[model samples]
Target chain A: MTRIKSDEPTGWFMIFPALAFVGTLILYPAVNSFTLSLHRIYMGLPALGEPFVGIDNYLHLLQDPVARQAFGVTFGFVILSTILEIILGLGIALVIHEHFKGRGWVRAAVLVPWAIPTVVASQMWRFIFNDQYGLANLVLFGDQVSLYVPWLAYPGYAFLAIVFADVWKTASFAGLLILAGLQVIPEDCYDAARIDGANAWQRFWHVTLPLLKPALLTALLFRTIDAFRVFDLVFVMTQGGPGDATQVIQFYGYKTLFTEGQVGYGTSISMAVFATIFILSLFYIRTVGSSLLKRETI
Target chain B: MRYTSKQAWLLGGILLSVMGSLFPFFWFVITSIKSQVRVEAIPPTWFPDWNFSFYQTVFTDHHFLRYIGNSLMVAGSTTVVALILGVPAAYALVRVRMAGKVWILGGLLTVSMFPQIVIVGPVWQMLSTMGGLNTHWGLVLPYVGLTLPLAIWILATFFKELPTELEEAARVDGCTTVQTMLKVMAPLAAPGIFTAAILTFIYAWNEFFLALLLLTDPVKQTLPVGIALFQGEFTMPWGEIAAASVLATLPLVVIVLVFQKGIVSGLSAGAVKS
Candidate 1:
C-alpha cells in the first residue's frame, strides 16, 4: 500500500469548516456553561454579568435534597432500564436471527418503535397508562377498576411506567446492534458445536455467548449512557410527576435552568451530569471498548 | 408435517415480541380515530368508530401543519448543513495524513455524547443575545452542531473503506482533491450519505428538549413539542393529541420502513465498528 504524502496545511483547510462550526457552537456553549457554573446567576440574570461564587454551586448541589433524590432516581432509572432493555433486546435478537418466514417484515416492524420520537412515544404510553381511560388499568384490573389509580400521578407507578416506556422505545435499538453482531458470527462455529453432539442450549451458551460478548458490551455501554442522561421521555410523560418521583438528573437540571431561572445552579447540575457520563464513558471505553475494537480488527 | 413443540415456542415468542413492539402504535392509531366521547368513555373503546374529526381538528384548529413545516425546515436544513461540513472533514481525516487526527475524531465522539441539558443554558443565552430565540434558525444552528459528529464519523468510515486506487485513478485523470471527492467519491458513498442524512434528519425532527427550550412560541414550535404541549382550550384533548401524535410520527415511520436497511446499518455503524 502506498502512503500518500498529503500537505498538512491542506488537510487543516479541508477540516476547518467542520472544526469551526463545532467549535463555535458546541465548544462555546460548553465553555460558557462551565464558566456559568462557577458563578451565582439567578433566573432572569444575564449569565455574563453574574457574580463569581467559586464552586459554591457545586457545594449547594450536594446539600440540596431534590438534587440528591434526582441522583437516586437517575441511578435507578439507568440500572433498571438498561437491564430490561438488554435482556429483551437479546431475546429479540436471538429470535430474529433465525431464518424464519416474514423475518424481513418483523425486522422492519421492530424499527418502528425506535424510529418514533421519544416525546411521541412517551405521550403514547401516557395515554395507555392513563387512570380512567388507559389500557393498562382496563386490562390489568378489568371490572374491579372502579377507583382512579393515576399511573403518572403516583410515584412508584410513575417511575415504573417511565421505565416500561423507555424499555419499549430503546430495546429495538439494542436488538439492532446485537443483530449486527450476530450477523458477523460465522455459521461454521455453530455447525462445529452441533457436530460435537452439543445440544441447542449448549451451543448457544458456549459458542454464541462468547462470540456475542463485544456486541452485548457495546449495546450495554450505549444504552447505559443514554439511560443515564434520559430527559425527553421523563420530561414528556410525567414532567417528573406526582412529586418528583420520575425526576432524573436531566429533568432536575432543566427545571433549575429553565423554569426556576437559576442558571448558575443549573449549569452546575449540568456539569455534574456531564462528569458522571464522562466517567462512565471512560470506564466503558477502558473495559469494553478495547476488547470490541480488538475483536473488530481480528 | 406437524410443527414441533420447539418450533411452536419460537413462533409464539416471535409473535409475542412483534405484537409487543407494534401494540403502542396500533393503540395510538386507534385512539386517534376514536371520538372524544369514546376516548373518555368508562370502558375505553377497543375499536375506533371511524370518527375523523380529531384529525380535522388537529390540522385546522391546532395549526399542526405549520409545526410540521417548521420541523421539516429545521431537520432538512440541519441535514444539509451537517453533510456539507461533515463530508469534507470526514474525507480529510480518512485520506489526509494529519497529526492529531485521532484526537480530533475522539473529540467529536465525546462531544456527540454530551447531554443536551448541559448545553441548553448556554445555548439559550447565546440565542437570546443574538435574537435567535423562538426562530427556526436558532434551533437549526444547534441541531447542525449536534448532528455533525455522527455524520462525520459515519462518512469517515465509508471514505476509509473506498479503495485508494480510485482516488489515484482520479488524480491521474487530472482531478484535484476537491474534484476527486465530489466527482468520484461522493457518488460511490451514496448509501453512507443517505444513512447519515436520514439519521440526522430523524434526530432533528424528533428532538424535543432543545425544541422545547429554544422555541417557546406556539407559532414556532416543532411537531414533537407542539403536539406534546397541545393542551386544549379547557381540559386535555386526548383525541386531538392522539391525532397530532400520529401525524407527527408518520413521516419518520414511513422513512424507516422504506429505508430499513440504511437505518439499521447507520444505527449500528458506531457501536459495531468500534
Candidate 2:
C-alpha cells in the first residue's frame, strides 16, 4: 500500500468529480433557495420588485393558517404512515423470511408496488376510490351503485386514503430493510429460545422484535423523511383539494412556487421543509443512527 | 407434509403478502387491456377481452415512445455518470488516505436527504439561465448529483470489503495506482457496481418532482411527468391512463423480477450502511 504522503493527492483527485457534481448542482441550489427565501420575488409580477423582506415571510408563515395546517397535515402523515408501514412491513418481512418454494417470485411480487411510479400509485388509488367505478365499491357492495363512497372527496377520508396509499407503496421497502436485520440475527438465538421451551409467539416477541430495532429505526428515519416529502400523491390524487385537506408541505410549496408564482414565499415554505427534515434527521441519526452504525461495525 | 395450525398461519401470511402486493397493479393491468365500456361498468368487468385500444392510443397519440426515449436517455445517462464518478470516489474513500473524509461522507448523506423542492427553484433558475432546460443533459446533471450518494456509499462498502492484499499484489507487479484500480479492484466490485446501477436507474426513472419542473416541454417530459399530466378534461380516460401506467411500469417490473436478488441485497445494504 502507498504511504499517506503520496496517497492523499490521488485520493482527492478521485473524489473530485463526484464532489463537483454534488456541490454545484445540489449544494449550490440548496443555498440559493435559502437566499431566495429572504427576498420577496413574485414570478408573475417582477415589477413589484424582488425586495429583501428578511424574516417577513417567516413571520407570515407563523400566522398563516393554511401553512400551519399544511405542516400539521405533513407531520400527521409522517406519524400515521410510518407507524402503519412499520407494522405491515414487519409482517411482510416475517412472511418472506421463511424458506418456501418460489420465494424469489414472492420477493418480486412484494416489490411491485415499490417499482411502480408514485404518480401511478396515486392514480391507481384515485381510480380505486372513484365513486362511479371503483374496485373498493365493487368489492364491498358488488352491484349496489348508491353505496359507493367518494373516498377523496371527504377531507378525513382523503387524508386517510393518502396514508393508506403511502403505506401500500413503501411497506415492501421497509420490509426489505427489516428483513436485512432479521437476516443478521443469529439462528442460534432462535434455537436457544426453542430449547428454553419457548413457543412461536414467545420466540418472535422476545428474540426477533428485540433484534430488529436498528433496521426498524432506519426504516422509520427514511420513511419519515420521505413522508414529509409527499407531493406527487397529493398532487395527482386530490390536487390538495376538498378544501386543502391533502396539502402536505411539499405540495403547498410547489403550488405557491410554481402555480401561485410567489417565488420568495414559496421558497420560504421549501426552506422550512428542508430545515424540518434536516433537524428531524439529525435527531434520528443522533438517537437511532449511531446505534445502527455501531451494530454494523460490530 | 402434515398441515398444522402454525403452517396454516404462515400460509395465510404468505397469501396476504402476495395478493396485497400484486392486486393493485394487477387490477391496473386488467384495466389497461379492457374495453372502455367494460372498464366503467358498475360491477367492473373482471375479465378483459384483451382490447388494447388504450395501449395503442397511448403508444401512438401520447408520444409514449418519445417519453420512453426521454426517460431512457435521462435515466441511462444518470446511471452511467453516477457510477463513473462514484466508483473511483468510493475506491479512494476506501483505499486512499484523505483529510476530512468522514465529513465529506456525512455531507453526501445530508445531500441525499434534500427535498427536491428546496433545490428545485434555484436549479430551475440556474438551468434556465444556462440554457440547460428542455435538454436531456439538464435532467441528467442533477440526477447524477442526486444519485451519487447511493452509488458512492454502496461502492465504498464493496471496495472496503476487498482485501488490500489484492491491490498490493497488483502493486508488486509494477502496476500504477490507476492501472491497479482499473484492472484488479474494479472487476471484483462488479456486482456491487451493478447493484448501484440498478438502484440509480430505478430512482432516475421514477423521479417525478424534478422531472416535472425541469423538463416542461412535451417532447422532453419523462414518463412519470407525462403520465401524470395525461388526465383529460371530458373523460378521466382511465383506460388510457391505465395503459400508459402499465406500459411505463412494465420495464421496472421486469427489472425487479429479473434482479430481485441484487435489488434486495442492494437496498438492504443501504439500510445497514447508511
- Which one is best on DockQ? 1
Docking class of 2: medium
Local distance difference test scores for all models: 0.88, 0.89
Tens digits of per-residue lDDT for model 1, A169-193: 9999999889888988999988999
Clashing pairs in 2: none
Off by over 4 Å in 2: A1-6, A289-298, B1-3
User: TM-score per model for chain B alone?
Assistant: 0.96, 0.96
The TM-score that candidate 2 achieves is 0.96
In model 1, the runs with Cα more than 4 Å from the true position are A1-5, A45-49, A293-298, B1-6
> Can you give the TM-score per candidate against the true fold?
0.96, 0.96
Clashing pairs in 1: A43-A261
Q: CAPRI verdict on model 1?
A: medium
Q: Candidate 1: lDDT of A29?
A: 92
